[model samples]
Target: MSANKKNFQVPYTGVTKIQVGKKLGTSRLYIQTPSETYKFKFQFIKLEQVESSIRSFLPSSVLIESGQLD
Candidate 1:
């Protein structure tokens, strides 16, 4: 739900936008912050479940965009 590595963390509050959709026949997740945009490819994983998890962790102020994957 959150991104963490060693001593670095990207808090949910820092997230400005989230986008879920298919690109080039691949399911992708895009998270945007003030200065960065992270892209993740969903392979063999359920995107809806992932989205739900992310939604649960994110603030209501964050914008989430959902697109049809089919």
Candidate 2:
């Protein structure tokens, strides 16, 4: 499953790092910020572990202070 779409919003400043994840065959969205972590089970099989794997492929998609969409 090659998910080529990344939808999120990272605050301007005072932000550290952002993370998102979702399970297979599901549209749930999980977010993890510096202050807290949240789970959003939009619909379908929005399991935690599967979403964890989706998040597993994130680091490489991370961007710096260059406004790069990655």
Candidate 3:
């Protein structure tokens, strides 16, 4: 059998907004840039740590928010 692989990368510099929210039993992080929006789902407990780590590398101009997921 043969398999194909792909690598996906997103740079932080173009980040325009970051939003962390909880839905069901998991936490979700949404990252928005000029061209696309990326979504990540993780354990609810790690939300803060993930947010802080992402914030450290991003500029203050980037808007970060926390709220319930729609």
How many pairs of residues collide in each model? 0, 1, 0
**Lowest lDDT block of 10, candidate 2:** 61-70
TM-score of each: 0.65, 0.30, 0.66
Task: Name the candidate that leads on TM-score.
Answer: 3
What is the C-alpha lDDT profile of model 2 across 27-46, one tens digit per residue?
44434467754455546454
Model 1 clashes, total count: 0
State the lDDT of candidate 3 residue by residue for 1-70, as single tens digits: 1253444456667777789888886878888889988888887467778678778987777778988866
Per-residue accuracy of model 1 over 1-70 as CA lDDT, tens digit each: 2355534457787877789887665677888889988877877767687688778977777777988633
**Model 3 weakest 10-residue run by lDDT:** 1-10
Poorest lDDT segment (10 consecutive residues) of candidate 1:
1-10
Alpha carbon lDDT of each predicted model: 0.76, 0.46, 0.78
3, model 2: CA deviation in Å? 38
Q: Clash pairs of candidate 2?
A: 22-51
